[model samples]
Target: MSSISRPSAAASAHAETIRFEAADGHPLEGTLTTGPGHGPLALISAATAVKRGFYQKFAESLVTEHGFRAALTYDYRGTGGSVSQDFNPRHISMADWGMKDFPAALARLELVAPGHRVVGVGQSYGGQALGLGNVSERFERYLMVATISGYWRNLGGGFKLYALMNLVANPVAFLVGHVPSGMGLGSGLPGGVFSDWTRWCNRPDYFFSEEPRFDAKNLFASVRTPILAIGATDDPWGTPAAREAIMRHFTNAPVETRWLDPQEAGGPIGHLDFFRSRFRETLWPEAIGWLKGEAQA
Candidate 1:
């Protein structure tokens, strides 16, 4: 509940580095962007292994540009600022990011902004985590960017099949208990996290394969919030079909998918570009407009 920072008057926004704990009492850290007071909340969840800094501009913009009361962004346990240098990757799993870490962020938002509407933007793996627990129902609306079922088959290339088969399904990842850096996942990921990710990616049903253990079907089906799912034509990992495959599980929610072409963006808007500051003028407004409309409706 402690926030540590002063407002930078120039931007009409302030960022506070706050410390919070998950339901499991797992300590976590994140940044809260807005004024000292609260109004409408914007929870910006990050992609797999993606840190809070990646969304700093977007979070702050929610307050200064989009008229949000506040925005929250954080790191999952065992990744980014939340984990210690000696952290053991084996202690965490991809499921924990949704069921545990995401809920914790929700609770933190609740503490900071009581009796107000909250909107969320879940990017990539973040969008998947939204359906993992009871948190999605709390948001007035949500926008998912580049979120997909990550099924290897949905993607093109025999190289993907070969690479995933030999690299991830083998003993190296299991023995090391982590996907080492330079694997293209940025900063790398805990072995437990990557293993669960591998399992989900291998299945067309993605996380549903972990059924019975987590009640993936009913858990996702329970969400009633309206969702806007965005897919980019250039994103190999989150193709339109791949994104739709996973979002289909939100049977109770009214979902909409909008595909963006790189040509319209004046450049490439890959799986990771939507949040980049350069798109603040082009793509971000589209997201903000949709969220405002949904949350108010």
Candidate 2:
């Protein structure tokens, strides 16, 4: 129901603006990249505070070196370039991204580029959204990096506070049309996204709880696509328990889980740096190797 601006000149050559209708009739914005070679298509979902540009470097790398035909990335409603006129910064919910934004993007891709084997790469909250969306047989494979399956008991200091504020302050902020100054976990998020994230943090089970259940485990169980779950040993957000929780959900999917430490990888790659840093020259090789192996099999 809201208009999304086209990609800027800096990104236009490698990206194109795409519009698609969701099952609920909401309009979704996306970026499509068609590289020179023929291969499977990849869709990238952004983390909580980052936008699609955060994925530009890695998507381009996948396109040029890996021979992928295209990569599609998009912003969920109320974030970055996809803000809606009806968007009340205090009233947004993470469920909107999982149920509406992500599915709409996938449906659009299916319509626009029919018959291509699609792959999804998700990071952090994006990984959660992908997990919530589930990997259907429509996709060739699924890759989850720095993903959190649920919030459970052992989140962290910042996250615990975030959850608390959402329970106590969010409604008050909504009535007053402002978010508390320190409520945001990370920078660059609009008030709506911040509030939505706060709500997730407040809940012990994250997206898997009965109250606002998104059926993440059901999605994983039904996935016919191969999966690769990547986590960093030093990432507090993607702790061992969190990573194991995600793996457990995908019981039926063929999956490989890797725990990477900067020391073991012979680099300083941490959680977010795996996509943003020069370590891609080392890291992507392993990823591509796995992808190729899966393709051959």
RMSD of each candidate relative to the true structure: 2.6, 3.9
Over the stretch 20-53, how does candidate 2's per-residue lDDT look in tens digits? 6556655567777666666778878877766777
Residue range 1-297, candidate 1, lDDT tens digits: 566785643368878888888887677899888764344798888998688889998887778877888889999887777775555777677888899989999888877668789888899888887899577778998999998887877764336654754575434568877667666556667777877877776677878867677888888999999999998889877766687789989999999888998898878988888888888888888888888883422
lDDT of each: 0.80, 0.67
Candidate 1 positional error at 18, Å: 1.3
The ten-residue window of minimal lDDT in model 2 covers 4-13
- Backbone clash pairs for candidate 1 read 177-191, 178-191
Residue 19, model 1: Cα distance from true site in angstroms: 1.4
What does the lDDT read for residue 5 in candidate 1?
83
